[model samples]
Every structure is written in C-alpha cells, then in structure tokens.
Target chain A: MSQLANVLNITKAPQPSCQAQRLTASKSLSARQQQELRAILEQGLPQVAQPYLAIAEQINASPDQVLAQIALWQEQGLIKRFGLVVKHRQLGFKANAMVVWDIADEQVDAVAKLLSSCPEVSLCYRRPRRLPDWRYNLFCMIHGTDRAIVEAQIAAIVDKFALQAVNKDILFSVKAYKQQGARYTKKGNCHG
Target chain B: MDKQSRQATTPVAELTALDKRIINLLQRGLPVVERPFLEIAQQLGCHEDEVLERLNHLMTNKVLTRFGPMFDAVCLGGAFTLAALAVPEPEFERVTEQVNSFDEVAHNYRRSHDFNMWFVVGAESAEQVNNVINDIESKTGLPVLNTPKLEEFYVQLYLPA
Candidate 1:
C-alpha cells in the first residue's frame, strides 16, 4: 500500500474501524509525556482556583509555565475549545442527529455563515459534494427538547430565510455506539 | 503533567509549544476500554497515572471541553437534523436553559445572528426526532426551523502542524 493508503488503512483496517491518522499522531509523542498527560487528563483537572498551580506542583512545574504553554497551544489551534463534555442522554436530552443541507453551490457560504452563527448549531462545516449519489455542502446541528420542537425550528428557519428552493433532510440518530473524542492513545504501539 | 498543567485557566488564545503538543494529543480523544490512559502514557513516555491525572486537570480547569465518543448519527440510526431559532440577546440564557432542559438535546450554544439560538437534537427514531422539534415549537411558542442532512460527509477538524 502507498503511504497515504497505509495511513487511511487504520480507520478501515481495524476490526472496530479505527482511524489510522490517530496512531500516526500518537507516535509523534514520546512515551513518557504521553503517559503523564494521559494520566492527568483522565484523572480530571485539579480542584481550587489556581488548579494549574496545583497540577504544576504535582508534575513539578510552575503554574505560570503550564499556563504559558497551554496558551501557545491554543494560539496554534492545537487545542480546540476546552469545556465540559456532558452525557446528553444522561441529562435527559437523548435524541442526537446531524442535519445536512443541500445548499445552492452559490449560497453555501452565505447559508453556512447564517447557520453557524446560531448557538444551537454547535458544529458547522463545509464539505465537498458527493458526486452522482450525494451532493450537500453545508452542515450544522440542531439539538432540542423534542422532535416537534426540532421540526418547528426547521420550519421557522425556512420561513425566516427564503430557503424554500434548498433541498434538506433530517438524518436522525438511531443509536450512538461511540459518541466521544477521537482516541489517540496507541500512536506508537501499532506500527506507524 | 504538573500542578501548573492542571490549571483550567489556560485559555485557547495563549498556548505554548508544550501546550500545543498536549492539546494535539487530547484532540485525538480517549481510547476505548479500561486503562486507556496507559496506552497514551506508553506512547508519550510518561507514567499511566500521570496521563490520567493531567486529563482530569485539563477537564477540571476547562482547558479541554469534552473528551469522549462522538457518534456517527447516520450509522447509529434515527433522524439527525439541524435547526435554529432567532433568540434575542436578553432571552438567550433563559431560552438556552429552557432548550437544554430536554434530554435529546446534546449540545446548546449561542451564535451571533438574529437566529442566534442553535442546538443539536438526537432521537431514538426519526419520528421521535421530528416530535421533539414539534414539542420545542409549542413550548417556546416559536417556529422550529429544520435543516436536515440531505447528504452526509465525515468532518475532522485537525489543523496542520
């Protein structure tokens, strides 16, 4: 297999459908720090106002140093938004779904901008149209209390914006076998 | 990972090389199964305990938002749709809490626009998904706009080093 093929193979090759790029990234991190970082994040952040300082003390570093480094990572976009990852179903908001929009090639950017600006649209992205069978460029999410409410909101969006010409469908989630962050714990062990 | 590393105050705006490396590691997500941290530690050259500790710290401090599985709604089943509501600024928080009260709603956030309120709704079945939308419309007394997925595509937001 070619190099690219090899990388993509992981996602395809794994019995459980693992993404290969993850392994490749894990390989980049040396053994020691990866281990340490894993432990820290899994254990959860420290308590107290200056938690970083507490963590620094545990890891034998100054709080300032840790903060400075974290700042740099954010600037580089290595770290996405940092917040709480709650159990939606546990919270009683069980229904999960991804809504794709068949935005006019010309109106994609505009529509995406408009859609993304809404808070409920947690994640929005631009994707290439799947030729022959699929063709959608704008994607966003809408989560709410109930189905009717979700539909009502869609109706409102159509009315609010003259998107009558747009082709859209709601792909509701059947089950969420895996709904968490992408794993990268085995970067080096799996022969990258 | 040390005490400093556990501080949740590390904002995304100011990260360092080490921070970048750590964040990059984190974005990859947590491994499935027991002792997942051990795997990360083995690769990163740190103790398994250290990795877990650091993850806890980051999560506690708010430097890392969520670290868990993100489902593929299409494969999972049920209807997946996107919708937005025009929530005024003054009512954003109240509306957000009201919207969040529903269990099907996974994530709730605020955006900048007349239709400022956006959220993701998941259901056990397609019919349930639609029903949830309908309920939202009635309760809020506001129209629910549905922008379902006509075509599906995988999205990975990994920035280049």
Candidate 2:
C-alpha cells in the first residue's frame, strides 16, 4: 500500500457514521446472467423462509446457485451494496447537504483522501469541473438529523482541513422528486 | 412543490422503537439464506413474522424507497450521468414534470442554486443517455449540464435512523 492509503487505513473517527470505504468503478458488464440477476436483486428478496429458492424459480436457477451468484457479483463490484435503501429524511436525517469544493489540481487527490476519511462524509467523489458555470470538482455528501448538526459538522471539516480559503457551495436537497434504483434491462426481473 | 415530491424537512411520523431497530439493522444487509428475516429476527431478538411485516409496511408506505441490491449502473453496461437545469421560476412546476417524464431519470432533486433542478439519468448505453439528455433539453427548452463522475474516492451510505 502507498503511504497515503496506509495513513487513511489507520485514521479512524471516534464516532463513525460510515466506515472509511473505497469505491472501485466498473465500466462494462460481463454476462446476460448478471444483468438478470441485477434486475431481480433490485426488487429485493421476497420475505419468506426460502427467498433464495423463490428467486431461483424466477430465473430457473437453484437456491445455492442464486446465493453463489450474489456473492460473486458483490466480489466483482457489480453490486455496490445489497441492503435496505431507506428514505433518509424519513429516518430523521432531514439535513442533507451536498458540498462541492474547488481544489487545486495537485491537492485534489490528497484532499479527497482526507475528506473521505471524515465520519460525517457519507459520499466523497472527484467529478469533472465544468468551467465557468460549475467550478467545484470535489463533491461530498453530509447528512444529519437537523440543520444545526449539519452546519457544525461542515464547520469542523473546514477547520480541520484548513479549507477556509476554498471556494465551495453547500446545496441542501430541497425536495426529492424521484429516487429509485437503476432499471437496467427491466425485462429480466418482471414476472407479471 | 408537487404531490410526488416529498418534503425533506420533516421526519416521517409514528415510528416505533422496533421500526428504528429494523431500519438500522436492515441497512447493513440481509444475508443470502433460506430464511434471512429469521436470522435478522434472531439477531434483534424479535419474531420473524414481525420483521417481515414491518419491512413490508415500510416499503408499502414509502418509508423505504428501495430495498435490496444497489447496482452500479455503469458496471451493468449502462450509462449514468448527473444533469441539471435552471428553470424559470414561473415554469418550475411544469418544467419539473417535463424533465421527470422520462423513465431513464432515476433520481431528481431540487437544490438551492441557480442550476436548481439536478437529476441523474441512467440508460442502457452512452448513446441512450445522450438521447435522454437531448430529449430533456428540447422538451424543457433548457440546457442540461451533464456531469459524470470523473473519479470515485469513496461511496458507502449507512445511516442509523
């Protein structure tokens, strides 16, 4: 591991909201089976004693086969996360802010590493800076139960990172018009 | 602004202690097993039927927008991009409806900025994604600033609700 990775690995927040995680990107899909698996997985497992068997029956696969495929897809990074996707605001995390930062090219990577390590940051990604109109490239999402908690968290990150001079914008999500998992090839999962 | 959009300011009312516990545990993930809910119930020291019933209720009531596998669209041979539009105040509602009419739009959020309406477009391929963008621009008569992820450092979302 590089020095930075080593440093980030050991840096643990006392009150961790999310584990210090890394996301590996995938550019292409491999098989049709995976696609079908994804669509079925999106609807999620049925609430039953033999959920895997139920899923298997849909695609003409066995229970063990379904389980193995899920494990394989996760390891291969096709499925980012297989769990409950809650409406966060419904869960008392009403204050959600997407903080975008304009960082110097050379420092962006190092800064991103540090920002990702913070407990408050649920998501940290380096996106392209659209010149003139949109200059902020670094995006991080912070969620709190209320506005005061969110503001305090942001202030602390700024102070800790010496980011007083950085140009950034905090865009709190005003409303969610539409939110759902990607329906990639919806043909695979629909039984009706 | 509209009936479809939920206000992000207020918490959903009438959540029991068990509901909170279920939300917190389910976020981690349910194992791939013969009886997954039973395992979760065992872990939480609750009845399996209660877990199943509460989960079904949560989804039915939109407390849980989605449950199950979260796929990286890009990984599944799909194109994904974040696009935004600065709609005129007078036509905000109309424009929102116009932009959201497309099935490819997976997520849309009204944010506090001039480019106020931000949404994510997911399609089977890059060409399709662009087609959706073009359709949105022409339909709404507003330029869509499409920004895709250049690099992802970290993305894991788990909240204790």
Candidate 3:
C-alpha cells in the first residue's frame, strides 16, 4: 500500500456506532452543566472518599448526576481517559526521546505495530513529512530514568525492527516549556 | 538563595511500592462510580481512606501532575497540529519565549535536533492552526515545519510504575 493509504487505514477512528453515541451525548448535557463540569474537571478530580459527591456539591448537582455525566462523557470519547496523569519526571523517567524513522511506505504499518508493542516504546504514530526539510514519517517515544538507558532501548528497537538501513533521528527533550491536559472548554464557559 | 541553588537543594520524593501500585491502578482509569475510591481500595485490599490519602499525597508531592478527565481537543471541535522549528543555537531562548507567548501553543519541548523546538498548537479551527504557525514564523524568523499527524497508528502510553 502507498504511504498515504497505509496511514488512512490506521487513522480511522472508532466505527459509526461509537460516533453516533458521541453525537447523542454532545447534545444530551445542557450547556450550563457542561461548563460547570468542565470547570471542575480542569481543576483535577478531588481526592476524597466520595469524589463525585464533592463535585456534585461544588457544581450544585446531585452525586448521581455527576457520576452519570462523567460516565457518559467517557463513553462519548469526549474524555479519553479519566485517571491519574503521572509526571514521568517524578516517576524517575527523566530521559525521554522522540525517535523518528523514514520507514518504507509498505512496511510502515507493520513496523509501527511492532514498535508500539515494545515495553519501552510508549507512543507511536505516523506523521506527514515536510519533504526537503523533514523526511522521517514514523515517530515513537521512549522514556527511561537515564539517558543511556533510553538510547540503548532505541538501539534495541532499531535492531528488532530491522530498520538498520532506514534514516532515523532521536530527539531527546532538553526542556519542557509547557505540558498539560488539553483545555477544550474555557474555565467559565463551556464553549471554547 | 538563587533559583539554581534552591533547585539543587530540594530533595526528590521517593515512591513506595504502594504509591507505585496506586499509580498503576489510576493509569488504567478510575472507576466510573459514585465511590470509585472505595472500589479501588477493595481491589488493593486496603481501606478507602488509605487509597484517598495516598492519592492526596501523590498530588501534593507532584508525582501526578493531574488526576481527572482527559479531553480530546479534536473531538471537541478544535484543531491541533505538531510543528517544529530549526532555531539557531544563540536565539533558542528568545524564540522559545516568542513561540510560547501564543495561547494556542500548548506543549513546547526543546529537542536535540536541527529542527530543535517542537510544540503542539491547538486552536478552534484549521485556519487558526495555520495562523499560529505563521505567527510563530514571523515572530521567530525561522521556518516552521508542520508535521501534523497524517494518521495515528496507536497512541497510548502505559508506564509501569
């Protein structure tokens, strides 16, 4: 398959059944409720015995309502995952690298799947190349507590995938200016 | 003390096995129920209060940067693209400040590469995404190579604590 066609095949989101559910959910919640929920969630879930009840009290909604809304949102895919967002740095994962590869068009998908299954490989995706300036098409992220370990993992990944001849680059992050959850709804307003 | 000295003196908080377990469980996802903590505690064979306490401690210690619902900006009618700029070594800091000045630029990272500065720009529309890239180029006077995901093969991270 062509590179574009290969990408298109995997880029497809969930089927229509899930999409229809998300659409129904998009209109089910009142704008005011969504705004209030978004505001509370943006602050992060409060750690308490009854967290939902706490949210309910703050939003002036019932506990059941808050729980139901969150459940619905998760089902709709509005909320990708609702849980603890660990600071990798704090978890001793100080060394992280974004490895980009110019895999052959036909083998990109198979290579991506193999790379994604690697224990050290955290994130893998296919991005378009910028031609003369940028040539790598496949990207994967590896995180380790030390720089050397991360580099070793990358070397192993290349060998395992038989990408010896492929052009690749490993970009280790030197600084992080900003990293936070995507804010879809404004703090006070539901609409962005 | 100066900023550099203060950072050097601060001790890194250690993670216990229980803390690791908590992180592992939470990463999978918090149960969608009225008393999710209770369920977690039950599974871990601990009390609900203990689970709550550890979570509170983790948040306080900054082990977990956030703990809540993660929204997909694209699904919510927003556009997001990953772009990078090959900034000159001397002007890197100034370019970083200029690029980060825009509200649309969500995550910016200084990576080791010719195209060194990488960031994600999220906006309400495709037009805004393009505009942000243009604005960054104008401000930094560097060519911005936009490499938005043509396709996402698999996007997930499961870091075992």
TM-score of chain B of each: 0.57, 0.74, 0.83
Those runs of model 1 whose alpha carbons end farther than 4 Å from true positions after fitting are A1-44, A178-192, B1-161
Candidate 3 stretches greater than 4 Å from native: A1-29, A177-192, B1-11, B153-161
What is the per-residue lDDT of model 1 for residues A20-105, given as tens digits with 9 covering 90 to 100? 21332233334454345435644444423345566566666555555554443333333322333432333233344456678878
Q: Kindly report, for each predicted structure in the order presented, the TM-score of its chain A compared with the true chain A.
A: 0.69, 0.69, 0.73
**Candidate 2 lDDT tens digits, A55-125:** 77777767777777776666765665656656666666788888999999998887888888776787777
- Indicate which candidate wins on TM-score: 3
Q: Grade the docking of candidate 3.
A: medium
DockQ of each: 0.04, 0.47, 0.51
- CA shift of B141, model 2, Å: 4.7
Q: CA lDDT, every prediction?
A: 0.49, 0.72, 0.74
Report the Cα lDDT for residue B127, model 3: 90
Tens digits of per-residue lDDT, candidate 2, B1-161, equal 55554474455656778887887787666776778889989999999999989988888877886677765555556667778898888999999889878888866888888888988777777898899999999999998887887666653454445
lDDT of 3: 0.74
TM-score of each: 0.44, 0.76, 0.83
Angstrom error of the Cα, residue A176, model 3: value is 3.3
